[model samples]
Target: MWSYITSIFGYFFKLQEDEGREKLLIEELIDLKLELEREEFHNQNIENKVQESSQQSECFQRTGFVTHCGESYILIDGSFYFDTSACSFNLNVNDKILYLGYNNSNEELVIVRILQNEGIGWENEDDSEEQRFDVINHIIVGIVDCREDRNVFIQGGDLKFNLDDVQGTFIPIAGDWLEMQCSIQKNDEKLTDINMTQVLQVTHFRPLRTKIKSGTVTEWSGKVGIIDNQIYFDSSTFIETFIPQVGAKIKYLRLIFNAMGLPQPKIGTVEEFQGQERPIILITTVRSTESLIQQDIKYTLGFVNSPKRLNVAITRAQISMILFCNPHLLSTDSLWNEVIMNAVNNNRYMGCYFPIEEK
Candidate 1:
């Protein structure tokens, strides 16, 4: 009888000990989670500081017309004298240039040839079409109406291209632009015995997409609250939700609505924000398709594949950049995978698929 009683006591004691250990483990896990969150916040703050400092160090690109030039310096718009020491070529008065250099101690611009210029009466219309033809940047306007194959037309200044042989990663649309290298070549067949000029192959097509993809619609209040310095929607759907009716006025801001009635923040797609910067940016990577991996891959994968677009998205943030995305989905791509790895290494990443070190 004593042995039986002792055995029961021992079992109860073991049960109590097991329960105590389990409680201790739960407490430890909670502590670890809180610590990780703090670490992630700290790491992200550090990255923001580094980015801000780096941007402050570099000079922003500027465009102004040259008013005059001395033997040593080029005067821009009769106000600023930019150092011409590094200019391999000479600049005359009234010349327009894109200058990419920093201001010196005297607050004068020291420039190099990051320039693009178009002067008054630069081209003569009387000149032969072939003579006027040269390679340059251009924007797609619309498709030309023809009984033959539908050909897209592009225009830049006096230059125009009937892009019959157009091919690109994305479909050609009106307002899409590209920086191309082109030339005018005479066609063998003549129009009424007159030699006809045609635009040659567009050697380079800059990947530009202005059309916003469809984004997941969040609560109305959530969208409204997020309106700040700069907001980037991964799609047009999200944009529509916030700015529902065109020209419909609602009061939360001191802002007036445009004809389109969009918010004050610079709202655009990831692709449209190329070569653009903002003090703060929020990127919402929306995934709403049923086949999340396959269908969304067309759009989401595009973001991951193009290094240029990624570069623009990341570097645009001068102060801070917040990415609203499912890391697991993004991790499938190589570029995004690298980002994940970097975030993990820096202790900035948090997700279910990857292991987080408690230490």
Candidate 2:
């Protein structure tokens, strides 16, 4: 009986040891869970701080106009010149822009983006007047209708304007595509009227027989001409090519035509040609280097990577659109790749390889 009692005491001691071990394990698990919670809270705080910093940076953006554009620098508001090394796109004088920099330091200024080209704003001569009128300029495209002597009109998509209200030297011709630069008058922030300042271009309407053509950069000679009522592209022709190295693309085209003794045709940037249609449009994708592929994709600045810009550039033509680009470089972007594939499927793609294959 005494031996039986000693065995029972030994069993009790073993039970107590097991309970102690379980308690210690529970405490350790609680501590680990608390540490995990603290870590998550710390990470969330860091993210919040980063977001706050980004918001503060955006708040510092300022508005200004480019008064002069040089090779290495651009003058803003005719007061300060900023370095252009960081700029991704070409800048021209009279471009209203938004910028980021310290108001007190001209050296720290950088242009962020262009607001508009050739912006015009006028207020009353009296500085203390509470009322104001704002004039904004726009480039518009529409189809002309000369059905009635007093009701001559131009209609484009959903917008229509009476030609009688517009002041320009253009004599309205029926079935012509009209592109005009006009001014919108706004009084107290309300749109009052639109007036055509100049007739930029006019193209006669033709029956839609669309043809797409693409060529390699090596084969681009900028030669364009018309034969038998159809436009032709030849690399060895005497007519000057429209190459936009700086300033406006239309300006370059005009200069080339003047040099070749041909009347200048209407040519403008994709941005300028929005809401406009033409019988023929030629687009040049200027980015060709392999080294710039990743950089251009990251920034979405040029034709190779900017899908929206490519869409705008290709869709502006109603009859024929000629595209000149390096096929290898354009294939790096998905949208551009689709464009090449579409052309290839239609048997419209024309490619040429470099004399020496690039490494």
Candidate 3:
């Protein structure tokens, strides 16, 4: 009876010498599914061939944390890989470094420092942390809230700490992923706040730099003492930017404007302004409470809310920065709130009935 059952099973599964019955069944099922589907649609107009690269010449410095330090290559921001065979600095992972490099055709960074020893933690530190720990344990915590130069509230597991002694060099913002050696005390009778003595590591899960097209054009005109300067506009304000739209037509008007001898500011998106700096920077924040497009707020406001983008935008100005934004909209972000508050404290804020004090 066992032999009869074996023959019946063998008839159904017809396995080859090299293949198993389950593998054959899976292949047959996949073939059936593929047969049911129609051919993928491809547009002939859109070339399928890989195109040769074209990226603008960049001459700007970028700041990024060393996410990885390999034997031959150093990875910055988890994406930018640089050959560090010639690097003089003994770099390590998590070291915040300023690198001046340009994007290659393959989108790799070619690092050659224009500025020397511009890494973070290069400044002098005088403040000392005083935390007397009764017990210590390695744990992970969720950042509930954070204030620069103040205590942080974190909650996760049994380890709850109002961390006042976070390392001054490493600060984690709200919603940041934090792992640290926690200084805690557990009462046999009760539970209390777990004191975090020192923050071991801070990892920000913020979005990477979006490569959305910034509509900027740079033109060069051979002239003595007078050169054509291109100005890049922020993406959030790009739609409402009148200067960039007006600046595009300035190429034709360069000769006309130069004959009149005016300071012509050509306009493009901020990505286009990467390697260039100007004497004046005019930024507009177009988002407002009155009018809002229902979309990914992170993506929409990414251009303005980013530290790197802000650093680029602000530092490009050699002397002055003129900002135009609805404070009501700008205050929606915590980072922007601090910026607006700073402006308010300094009396630099110029807006009608904004919730500056409330923020």
Candidate 4:
């Protein structure tokens, strides 16, 4: 009985193989019959004709319109469409792809793979953060608050910071940090009862240039200025500020005081400012504020560069000049006492401080 079963199984397997071959033959015969009837080729040795399906594994490259793409599949639109076996790309919703196909079935366009460093072209650099420079240009909406020496907090966005200050629909290109040494007319914002108004002319363009402090700190009593490495004020107020290097510039600045919620704080010491040599912008804050008090001392700061560091501190108001920011400037080195020092325990200034001084 076992022998009989084995013979039956063997017979069935051979039959199935014969059937598969027979089907292929039948299809070929039908196609050939039609071709013969149509007189396409001479006395055709159809059986001897090489079957190219076996050689379909030969790889080939082609360019075609991207008709469709699924999770891991790509259908190239062409005269003869093929399954993209293995490829890569940074394709958007409708990005065309160049496919490389090996065997007929083992082919594809792997987008994730192409987005990798080795796969993509020079565009791979956009993925790195070190070489990225993101510059944003916006109009001066308003000033939120200020620091002691010359750090002013500002508020404004949604507007483009363009060279021509033109408004229109445009695409946002990514970058690392902004590099600016130009000034625009500051009109409405008003800051008064503030010393170091000479700090009106701001100058900061690079990161290392942000750390700046004045020669000294003076009091609100008399016009403030420094002498002999000691802070001296009118009513006799003073703070020991960093004398800075011989050619000290606005490269090293320190914050004395600043209101919360406001990004760029005003009232700071210009530790360094390489004024005469190059233009380096210093971005202290990138925030906005809703609450402010004008009934008392308040100041705002911004960059100045009409030709070189033009003042944009107070746009439409009259203010007293107290501090000057120049990396290579000649100011007293004794008025470092006025640097405001208020630690922000909270980030949000909603119901925080209602500037009751304004009421």
Best by lDDT: 2
Q: Write the per-residue lDDT of candidate 4 for residues 131-242, one digit (tens) a residue.
A: 1111111111123222222222322211123322221122222331222221211111221111221111112221121223344232132343322122221211223353
Which stretch of 10 consecutive residues in model 4 shows the poorest summed lDDT? 335-344
Residue 110 C-alpha lDDT in model 4: 18
TM-score of 2: 0.28
TM-score of 4: 0.16
Highest TM-score, which number? 2
How well is each residue in 98-169 modelled by candidate 3, as lDDT tens digits? 665544457665554312333554222332122222221212234444443454545421222333423222
For lDDT, candidate 1 versus 3, the one ahead is: 1
Residue 70 lDDT (model 3): 84
What tens digits encode model 1's per-residue C-alpha lDDT throughout 1-359? 99999999999999999999999999999999998797667544543443343332333346667777788787775677665543444577666565544443476664434345545322222321111111212122222122223444443222233355333333455655443322222222321111111222332233422322122223233223112211112223234445533233333221211101233477778877777889899887665333556654466564645667677777889897777677766666678677667778886765466744322
The per-model lDDT (C-alpha) reads 0.47, 0.49, 0.45, 0.28
Ranked candidates (TM-score, high to low): 2, 3, 1, 4
Candidate order (lDDT): 2, 1, 3, 4
- Judging by TM-score, tell me the better candidate of 1 and 2: 2
C-alpha TM-score for every candidate: 0.27, 0.28, 0.28, 0.16
